[model samples]
Target: MTEIEKHQYDVVVIGAGGSGLRAAIAAHEAGAKTAIVCKSLLGKAHTVMAEGGIAAAMGNRWPEDNWEVHFRDTMRGGKMLNNWRMAQLHAQEAPERVQELEDWGALFDRTDDGLISQRDFGGHRYARLAHVGDRTGLEMIRTLQQRAVALGIDVFMECTVTDLFKDGSGAISGAFAYWRETGTFLAFEAPSVVLATGGIGKSFKVTSNSWEYTGDGHALALRAGAALINMEFVQFHPTGMVWPPSVKGLLVTESVRGDGGVLKNSDGERFMFNHIPEFFKAETADTIEEADRWYDDKKNNRRPPELLPRDEVARAINAEIKAGRGSPHGGVFLDIASRRTPEFIHKRLPSMYHQFKELADVDITKEPMEIGPTCHYVMGGVEVDPDTELSAVPGLYAVGECSGGMHGSNRLGGNSLSDLIVFGKRAGEAAAERASSLTERSGVPDDVLAEAEAEALAPFDSKGAENAYTIQADLQQTMNDLVGIIRKADELELSLKEIEALKERAAHLHVDGGRAYNPGWHLSIDIHNMLLVSECIAKAALTREESRGGHTRDDFPGPDPEWGAKNLVLTLNDARDGVDLVEKPLPIMPDELKTFFEDK
Candidate 1:
């Protein structure tokens, strides 16, 4: 029998990104003996890759900007499919959270009057993102890390939790994890478990997500009897590096367009105007002159069509590419060189300028960037209560990118950062409270621990000749090709069949070498998570016969009101081998909140 390590905590928060750190802080402050378990070293989470800024209705740039307007914009941006309560709470509380971060020493860029400055982003009615130049995520992480350290929060770095354990009553008891360095099995015994693990982007071939994003939290939630909502809505960001094959799919921040960059086709025409949807025609500028003037005089002119929601823009770029007007590299050109000066570009977008110059050998100050859509974020995740961020499963809380319903069918840029802090704090506080109410921490059964250990070591014992890396690569390719940004029923069905075959291959995966520092062993485990979540996405896409936000069915080609009124929920099947999906009605918004959408 392999010896297993054990630890006890009032609350155990998984993942160490923006949401995890924030949740740990909130839980610690709420008097819970908290421990944060992360897959990477502290401060190296995917949160650092976020470049645009944090969204909050601070009214720093425009006094007319407030939570009401922010809420309206969020609902509209999500195509009104958002969980009304979650959207309402996020908009109302984001300003306070931003101020809290600043109070905890996050130094945001300031206006001329020394107030925290705001910048424009897609789908927002006002300039509302609080930034630290282009490295806003880095700054936020640094500040949060400093606060977490000061609070004396416990952190277990480079630890991966493979499965969530439940007690006899079906409540979360603990989690089974392993250290990456030594591959030692460990169990966390806690009354409350908060999953702050981020998105499931690594399931796709071309994505901005790192290796750590293998849908671990989502899979854990599903297996633990929690439901996942909106699994089909995957966000393919409008701008990503398309040249220099080695650097393909790297993110190009929306801050570029937010500042002044324009999208052009091979004919050197600003084509976003021609692709504006009817829903946004009243608010988007149709002419080049009006759009240019709107940058300086927003009160008089409508915003540019280039600033349309990400789904629309990504589809427009896709349309332009298919029509043979794409750039030489099979992408469209994003020209900031012609719109802004060298000094302005460097001052406002130093990271982008450096990224292009270093990675793709293209200087943004003098030339255009070849850019296209790349899988960025998933709108679907573990379903949770709006106020507490607690899932249907007791003692299990979820926040950040791992939790669903907050973004609805689509997520607006910058809202992700705000969602992290707002709901991170909420989940942390709620988790701590739940822990305090429990008489004692639930114990991980000896049999459960042994079973988990055997499962983890199965790859080493397998005699089958299957490579984990090959299976993972094939799965990524399958998802990218068949169930990508544009989906069709026939393709989705084929993708499901492909996923089923990959799952069979994954079961026979064999890893070589000792467990210590074995990357192959780690990937073999992650492949299970990727395969599970990818099936949920493909399954949900096939069931929903309409286009909305991030989920676009090419066969359907447009949004259907009947489908818009429902959300697809995925839960673990009885056998625990596959997922079962069901449609549920969307939560209704109150009359007061509904008034915001009446005129628009």
Candidate 2:
């Protein structure tokens, strides 16, 4: 048996992103011994990749913007599939959370009136995103990190958690992890575990997410007997760099469009005007003059089609590219040079300027950018209680992108940061309360640890094993080609068969080197998570026969009223190797909240 190092904490947070840091801070402040375990170094979590801004209704730029308005926009943006309570709570608490960040020493851009500046984003009725130019997420992380350090929170960096253990009563006991540097096994015995691990974008070939986002939290929750919801809804951001294969899926911040950039085709035609769906016709401008005017006089005119929700924009871009109006690089053009001056572009979008100039040799001040949709965020994850952020599994919690029901079908730009702080704090408080209630810490049985150790070391003992990279590449290609932004029943069915085959291949994965600093070994473990989560996504997509936000089925072609009233929930089957899908009715919205959508 392999000896394992052990430690104990009241609460363990698995991830170091904005949500994890915030949760650790909340747990520590609540007098719980909290530890944050992450696969990467501190401050290098995927949240730093967010370049747009944080969505919060501070009413800094528009006094009419309040929680009610924000909530309405959120529900509408998600295509009315959001959990009403979560949306209401998020809208009500986001402002205070943003203010708390400022009090904790984070700086944000200010308006002419000396208030925190707000910017325009798709699906928002008013300019509501509080940002620090194009690096709001970076500033948010710096502030959260400083606060956590000041509070003396414990953080285990460069550690990967592979399995979560449960006590005899079916409550969370602790987590089994390995150090990335030496692959030494360690275990934490904690009453409460918070899974703040982010999304599953890395499963796709062209994505904006980094390698760390391999569905760790989702798969962990599933394996631990927790249910998952909304696995079918995956967001594809409409603006990823298309030229230069090295940076093919790199994100082009929506801030570019919020700051006056427009999308055009190879013929220099603003094509978004031609693709406005009937659902948004009342709020979207039909002509260029009206669309351009709305940027300045938002009160009197409708929003531009260029600023529609990400789902609409991505589909439109795909349609244009397929119709042969795309740029030379098989994408459309995003133009800001003709709209904004060079100095203004430099001040407002410095990162974008540098990213394009250094990587693609494109100057935003003089030329357009070739961009297309790239796999971004997954709206599906561990099903959690809206208030406590607790999953179905006792003593386990989930937040940020790893928890479902907050954003129903699609998440709006900027909402992700707010979701982190708002629910991060809630989950932390709940986790601490649960920890305090437990009289004695649970212990992991020796046999469980031994089984985990054997599983971890299986790659070395397999005969006629396949290469991990080949299986991963095949999985990515399958997901990208068949289960991408546009899906069909036939393709989704095909994807499941392919995923099953890959799972078989992954079981016999062979790594050539010892675990110490071995990228192949790390991938071998991570591929299991990606495969499990991918199966859930494919299965749910095939079951839900409708086209909605973030989930478009070519066979259905449009949203179904029956499907809109229900959400698909997934759980581990009896065999414990596959997921079983069931439909649950959508949460009922109260009368007061329903009033906001009466006329619309």
Candidate 3:
């Protein structure tokens, strides 16, 4: 038998990323003894690598900009598939959250008035993203990390949570985890658990997320009987490195465009103008005159061509790259050198400049950077009430990139940071309030604990049957091949077969190493979650027969009105199986929205 270990906390938070840290602090402040368990050092979660700014209506640039406008922008940016309540709540609370960060010692870039500055980003109507230059996520994560430490919350670094412990009545009481350094099993008992584990980019071959993003929270929450929604709409950021195949998938920040960069094909033709829709065409500039005019005029008749929604821009770039109009690197160029001074470029986008210089040996201050689409964020995750952020399972809570129904179809460029702050606090508060009500320890079910242990050890017993590296590579290749930017029914069917075979093989995979921070051993376990998540995404993609937001199908081809009105939900159809896709109606905009206009 595997060694058994147990521990307790008032609240056990899985993942020490930005959202997890935020949740722990909130839980601690709510008078719960909270503990944060993570897969890395306390401050090194992928959140620190976020390049764009946090979306907020701080009104530093324009006093007229408010939460209502922020809400409208988010709705339209998401192509109107957003849960309006969550959107509304996120926009309204974001300003306070940004200020809350400042109070916790976050020093955002300042405007002439000595207030936090905002920047223009795709999907947002105004320059409303409060930023710390371009490394806003790093600032946000570090600020929150400091506060979490100051609050005296217990942090378990280098710990991987393998299982969630539930009581006899099916309530989650704690979790089962592992120490990466020593390869030891540790169990955590808490009245409540919050899963803030981020996006699932590692599921694909080419992605912007780090290896940590293997859908751990999605898998854990589902195992604990929670409902996950919208696992289908993974956002493919329009930019990523493209040279060395090993790092071709790292994210290229959107700030390059916001700082006046333009997408150019190998022939040097700007491509975004061709894709703007007729309804937004008048509002969106296709010509240089209009593009220049809109930027200068606040209530301009035309929208800046450079500020096109992320989906439109990404699709346009994809088409250009596919038609053999791409640069030598199978990607397009994002040119910023001609638009700004070297000093300004370095000051505003220091990390981006440094990343390219170090990683790709290209200096952005001189040459245009190469970029292509890469899977970055998942808009679909476990469903929760917009107000409370609680999942279908009573004791289970999800936030950050793990929780879903907030970003509708395609997430807007800068909304993810705000999504983390707004909902992270709500989930923390709700989980704490729920934990407070449970005055006594309900017994942690041993069977559930044992099941988790069994799954974790399957790789050890099966010797030389399969390779972890090969399974992961094949799984990612399969996802990238079939479930990428463009999809077809037959290709998706083929992909499903590959996923099933990978799972069966994973059951017999072998890792010839001790569990002491063995990436191969850990990856063997992470593959299970990725496979589960990939199936839901592919299945949901196959079910939705039309083009809408991030989900585009070549066979069905166009957006269907019926499909537009509903959200795709994934949950357990049976206690024995994993996930099943179902459709739920999206909330209609009230009579006021037509006049108010999203992103107004």
lDDT tens digits, residue span 423-472, model 1? 99999999999999987556988999999999999999998889989998
Give TM-scores for every candidate, taking all chains together and pairing residue i with residue i: 0.99, 0.99, 0.96
Candidate 3 regions exceeding 4 Å error are: 294-301, 445-448, 573-578, 588-595, 598-600
Model 3 per-residue lDDT tens digits across residues 354-386 = 988998899999999999988888989988888
Full-model lDDT for every candidate: 0.93, 0.93, 0.83
Cα distance off (Å), candidate 1, residue 522: 0.4
Q: Say which prediction, candidate 2 or candidate 3, comes out ahead on TM-score.
A: 2
Candidate 2 clashing pairs, residues 3+ apart or interchain:
none
How many clashing residue pairs are found in candidate 1? 0
Question: Clashes per prediction?
Answer: 0, 0, 4
lDDT of 2 by residue, 123-239 (tens): 888899999989988999999999998888988999999999999899999999999999899999999999999999999999999989999999999999999998999999999
Could you tell me how far off, in angstroms, the CA of residue 115 lies in candidate 2 after the best superposition?
Answer: 0.5
In terms of lDDT, which candidate is stronger, 1 or 3?
1
What TM-score does candidate 1 reach? Answer: 0.99
Task: Candidate 3: give the clashing pairs.
Answer: 72-599, 73-599, 230-380, 283-303
RMSD after CA superposition, every candidate: 0.8, 0.9, 1.8
Q: Return the lDDT, model 2, position 438.
A: 79
Residue 57, model 1: Cα distance from true site in angstroms: 0.8
